[model samples]
Every structure is written in C-alpha cells, then in structure tokens.
Target: MFLNKNRFFSNTDLIGFALLALLIFVMLPVGLDVFRLNLFGKYLTYAFVAIGLVLCWGAGGILSLGQGVFFGLGGYCMAMFLKLEASSPEATKIQSTPGIPDFMDWNQIAEIPFWWQPFHSLTFSLVAVIIIPVIFAFIIGVAMFRRRVGGVYFAIITQAIAAILTILIIGQQGYTGGVNGITDLRTLKGWDIRTDDAKVILYFVNGGLLFACLFIAQIIRKSKLGRILIAMRDQEDRVRFSGYDVANFKIFVFCAGAAFAAVGGAMFTLQVGFMSPSFVGIVPSIEMVIFCAVGGRLSIIGAVYGALLVNLAKTTFSELFPELWLLGLGGLFIAVVLAFPNGLAGIYKDYVEPRIALIFKRKMHIDEDVSKYDPLEAAAD
Candidate 1:
C-alpha cells in the first residue's frame, strides 16, 4: 500500500522543517548559555546518525545495528589529524620523544604508525571520513544482501562487527590508546576549539551540516529508488524476480547511511574533543537505532527530533536522578513501542494533520458557496 506513495512534502512537512530550523538556529542559541548550547550541539551530532537510520532502516528496510562503527571511524579519522597537529614537536617538548602523540610517547612507541601517516593531511582525513565508512558498509551489504541474507540475521552480523571493532581498538593500546581511547585533543589547524567562541561556531556548523543531510535524505525518500526500496522491504523476492538487483540498491543505501554517520562522527570529534571505542560498541550502536525508532523510522524529520529529545532526556535524567535514569529510559522505550509505533511523526499524521486538512476543506467549501451567491455577479453580466 505504501509502495505507490510519492507525496514528498505535504504542508505538514514544510511547517515541521521550518520549526526545526527555528529551534536549532534561534531558540536554543538565544535561550541557553554557552555550556548548555554546546551540549545541544553534541546532541545534534547524534541526529546525523538518526537521519542515516531513517534512510537505511526506515526507507530501505535495512536494519543495521552497527551505525556506531561508522560514527567512531569518522570521529577517529578527524581526531587523528587534530592529535597530530596538537602533538607537534614544539608542543610535545616535554615528552621523551618530542614529536609523537602523548599516548604514543607514554606507551614508548618510537615512531608514528604507517596507517596514521595519512591522517596528518587534513584533506586526506576528510575524504577518508566519508570513503572509509562507505567501503566498509559496501562490503557488508554486498556479502549479506547478495546471498539473500537479511532480517534478524543481518542485524546480528552488524552487531558482531561492532563488537569486534571495539575489541580490536581496546586491544591495540600502542596504536589506538586502549581503553582510554583518544584524549587530550586541544586544537584544530592552530585554532583553539576549546574556546567559547569556537564552541558556538561549531554548533552552527553542526546544525548546518545536519540540515544538508536532511535535504539529501528527503530527495532520496521521494525518488523512484525509494519506492523500490519499500517494495523490497515488503517483498524482496518479488522485487528480485521483477529484474531489479535488490542487493545493489541495498548496498547503495547502506553506504549512503554510513557516509552520513561518518560526517556526524567527524563533527563529534571536533565538538566533543575525543574519539573512543566507547562509541563504537554494542551499547552505543543499539542506542543509535533507538533514536531512529523513537523518531519514526519512516520519517526523516522525525528522526532528527527523536535523537534530540532522547539525548536531551538522557542528560537531564542522568544528572537529576542518576540511579533512576535507566528506569526512565526503559519506560520511555516501552512507551514508544507500545503507544506509538509510528512515533512523534505518526501522532502528527494521525491527529494533527487531519484537523489541518479539515479546516482547509471547510474554508474552500465556504469560498465556493460565497462565489455562487455574489449579488454583483448578475449586474456585471
């Protein structure tokens, strides 16, 4: 039933996006202090991951449980560049090896690793942030979707990949900084990112990038490829038999999702000042999926809201009631599942939209009757 649906943006979509723009660019910035605003900026990074999930899981029916893998990869890429810049020989003069990163010097590594060399160039790191995730996602998508392996099997495989990456990062202390992960990141290209001014600037940049992703996702969701994805989700066998290479489409969308996530990761590194395996593991990956589900997997805009609201709640609850925070989160998840499967967007679609449509219909009917009854009409004729 949803396959033939092509209406991209109703009046509802326009209004929703407008409000989101206002909230991000004006309301939050005006209402909050620098510290609080920076926290919101951190939340906005997660919105990138949520937006990706809207495309891959919502529109394309690919439930990837390892989004954090891409996010961490992108963040680590950016962090490596920043780390190198911050670890210049002059900056690290106190260390025994005055040119290497602090962690490496502490770990007694004699020289920079070969793989870390590429990240010394900002241009290369930026490209790698997007390309690396796309390649990794493409490999996984091809392996699974080609053989018709999907559903829960696909989810499990993605989760396992997340686990393996976390383990590897933790094990390679000499390379990855071990359980401590990457820390002490201070500057970017000689600019002090820890300053209040930089924080505000980064927040705006993060918001701008998020909206760009949203626009791209909307275009994809309304295209012919989008319809086919829905078709495959509902009936993969039918789509394949109809001569479509379903696997190829799945790979494309999954890679697209990973790219979105990579951007978020890089932004997280810039704004939050570190990258760690803590973000690339099972807990974080699952939480990222929850953001999409709560936002309404089918609705791109809703996913953004879902991420912001969930993260906001997590911070507030954990701060106010540390012991009860998990309880609150569990209840929130249950409420979303049991009460609103379609999420915030579903509520708008079912209740709010109908009222708006009814008002418009009534206004049109009144205008038609008034036109017919115009007394000046006869005299003019």
Candidate 2:
C-alpha cells in the first residue's frame, strides 16, 4: 500500500540514502570509540525531529517551533519506566517512599501517582512515548487547522505551548522532574544501560530507528499524499476547492512530526540517562528549527547531516571557545541563511550533482547527455 512507482526518489535519493547509511552504520561506528559514538548517537536523535520538520514545515508549510514538547514527552515516558526500575524498594531504601522516584520523594509525595504507575510497565511506557505526543499534536492540529489558523500564528502558538509546558514541568516538581528533570535513569528491563557495551548497542539502535524514520519520510514524500501536500503548500485554495480536506492533511503531518520527535526523545533518555525541562522549552525548540533549516528542510537526508554538523560544531566550538561559542554559532547560522538559503542540500543540488554527472559521463562510453534525474524538471515539461 505504501509502495512508490519510482516517483519522487530517483537515483539521487537512493545514493544519498546509501551514503548516509554507510556513514552512520559503518564508518562512524568503526572509527569512533564508544564514548564518541554515543555522542553522535545523541545528535542523530535530533535528526528525527529534523526529518519531522521536513514533512511539517518543508512539504506541508507547517512550521511548528514546539517540537521539543513532543520530544520531551517521549523521553520522559521512557525515563518514567526506567526510573521505576531503578527506584525499586531495594534501591530506594534510603528514601522515605521506598518505590517512588527520587524527585517524587524529594517533593514529599507519599505514593506513586496513578498516571505514573502505568509507566512501570515497559509496554505501556513504550506506547506512551509515541502515542502521547501524537495525541497532543492531534488536539493542537484540530484546534488550529480547523479554524484556519496557520503561518506565523501557528508557529507562535507552538512556541508558546513549549513555554507553557516547560513552566508546567518545572512547577509540578513532584510529578514531573522540575528543573533538573528525570535523572539517574538506570537499566532497561534489568539490562545495565550505563555500561560501555550497552552504550554501543543503544547507539546502533538509535541509528536503526533513524533509518526507519528516513525511509518512512521518503515513502510519504513520493506518494500521492506527498504530492497533495506540496500542492497545498503552494496553492492551498486550489487544493481545498478540489474536494480535499486540507486541514486533516496538516493535522496528520503535524502529528507525524510529533511522533517522530517522541521516538527521538525516548532514544535520548536511553543514551543520555536523563530527561529534563531544559529540553522541553523554547530555546531547544528554536534550535530544532535551526537544525531543519540548516539541513535544507526539503531534503530528509540533508536534515540528518545538518543535525550532525550543527551539533558537531556545537560540541567542538563550545569546548574550544567557551564564552565565544554562542557568537560563533549565531554567525554560522546567519551565514548559512544569508548566503545559502537552500542549505547543504541546495549546495549539493547546484554544485555537487552536476559534477557527479560529469564524472559519470566519462564512465558511460556512449552517452551524449544524461541527467541523474530531477522530478521537478520532469514535471515542468
């Protein structure tokens, strides 16, 4: 049902996908130690959010700046379960409440909250990671899109929601983790997640999940729905007059972005050992948008690279420059936006692809002219 008839993705996309797979799964894993690989794994989680943005903002023209809300929700869901495991009666003998999370105890909560009790089950926690965020997205989508609320208004609303959620998390210190967030997450179903071997395994899991999301994004991009999204992005009135419910489409994509963010959040908690309000706020959400924009939001694969490069620069420059790091990053983002609005993907499209065709021309013995194939060009004729 989801198969594409060789539609959107051409050889260019296939090659892009292959190269990314090789780098994330093969090259990086082999070259870097477990510590460095885990750091990259953290960055890859951000790629999930960036890919979601490709569909929401890039294809559908829905710019949601509150993606961190979903990401944090997902991470917190996973963290809830892990914290329960780590807060077993034996482990929390020091606490007043023998089986409650440390934060809950610190806040003087006497019993595990009913909502949190369900997360003690791994199955429920796993489902909640994706389902909860998607549900929230659905409500927001319906409220906004049904009312024809969009453009910058929608963006502002999402950003405001991120702020509200962050405040809520911090205010409800007993139930949520407050400013420190959920911490000391240990073991997943009795497997020690803090070990070096466990970190490597989790890194691979993160990479595998990223590919799954990327493939799903490609399939959506190449399908009929994807085309409709593009059309709607460009000419909404025309699509609305053509007997399609545009609001539903926007809602679906927005919710889908939330779901992707949820998975990333869950992976982040596993790899980073914590989930905090710091990740669920306005600043991180804006940074997520930066990831999508810098990556060339139109290209899912480019989003992944963008997340890696931006984060790589973040880690490297912050360590080296410390005080000057923010200035450097701001300058870099400004440079990319002003000089190369299309971003890394746009650069490749204009410069790298033509060169590739030139290189292949030498290899093809009887080729007069051959294109790698661009869908938009074909569509114009």
Name the top lDDT candidate: 2
lDDT of 1 by residue, 1-381 (tens): 132234676455678889999999999999999999999999889999999998888877889999999999999999999999989999999999998998898889989999999999989999999999989999999899999888899999999999999999999888988888888899888899999999999999999999999989888877888878888887888999999999999999999999999999999999999999999999999999889888888788889999999999899989999989999878877988899877787776666765676677697774433333223321111
Kindly give the stretch of ten consecutive residues in candidate 2 with the minimal lDDT sum: 372-381
What's the residue-level lDDT of 252 in candidate 1? 93
Give all TM-scores, in the order shown.
0.93, 0.95
**Residue 290 shift from truth in candidate 1, angstroms:** 0.8
Q: Where does candidate 2 clash, by residue pair?
A: none
Candidate 1 residue spans exceeding 4 A from truth: 1-8, 360-381
Query: What tens-digit string does per-residue lDDT give for candidate 2 at 1-381?
Result: 123335566767889999999999999999999899999999999999999999998899999999999999999999999999999999999998898899999999999989988998999999999999999999999999999999999999999999999999999999998999999988999999999999999999999999999989988888788888988999999999999999999999999899999999999999999999999999999899889888887889989999999999999988998988899878877987899776788888878877777887888764746544454643311
TM-score quality measure for candidate 1 = 0.93
